[model samples]
Target: MNVTLFSKPDCKQCDFTKRGFDKHGIDYVTVDVTADDSGRQKCIDLGYSSMPVVLVESGQEIVHWSGFRMDEIKALAYLEGAPQ
Candidate 1:
């Protein structure tokens, strides 16, 4: 499983979300919208017009959402065998 966080530097929710992942020891790659044009377009293409977008991939399935979804992250961390 792979988790990617799409965020800009000024987004507090994005920082909070990343902190949550760190707290649970969940590994993820962050894509900065203000810098990465292609990555930013992808985030926009995923039906998210906001920062703090998260894309989750498990096997051939990919899912995405925006905001600080703690409950969802917890489940994803477990699915990825992250230390709880």
Candidate 2:
């Protein structure tokens, strides 16, 4: 599984998301939306008006969401059939 976190500076939700991932030991790539126009465009394209967006890619499946979703994070941390 590949995880990408799209975030901006000084975003509390982004900080929470990063801390959650860190606490769960989930390695993810960070994309700074403020630093890159393309990254910011991605958030807009995804129809998100939030600070932090999480994109997850597992094989042929791709999932994405915005905000600090601990439920989703927990599910990702303990996904069935995923390599442990």
Candidate 3:
């Protein structure tokens, strides 16, 4: 499963969220909105007018959290292993 995190540099919440993902050993791609125009557009395209948005592989969004909740993220990640 792919996890995409859209964030900007110097964002404390973004740093905190990344740390949670790292602690969980989850592999995710980070998109720095300030560094890439396209990345910023992508975040806007998702209807998120804020930073630190997380997109799960199944097209579900777990966003707008001040900090990453491990249990919620893990539950979403575990959905990848759910039987169809």
C-alpha lDDT score of every prediction, in listed order: 0.90, 0.89, 0.71
Query: Worst 10-residue stretch by lDDT in candidate 2?
Result: 75-84
Deviation from native of the Cα of residue 40 in model 1, angstroms: 1.0
lDDT of 3 by residue, 19-76 (tens): 8777667678998988989978877787777778787664464443324556656665
| TM-score versus the correct structure, for each prediction | 0.92, 0.90, 0.73
Candidate rank order under TM-score: 1, 2, 3
Candidate 1 lands at a TM-score of 0.92
| Residue 3 error, candidate 1, Å | 1.0
TM-score of 2: 0.90
Q: For candidate 2, give the lDDT of residue 43.
A: 86
State the lDDT of candidate 1 residue by residue for 1-84, as single tens digits: 788999999899999999999988888999999999998999879888888999988789998889999988888878877877
Pitting candidate 1 against candidate 2, the one with the higher TM-score is: 1
The regions of model 1 sitting more than 4 angstroms off are: none
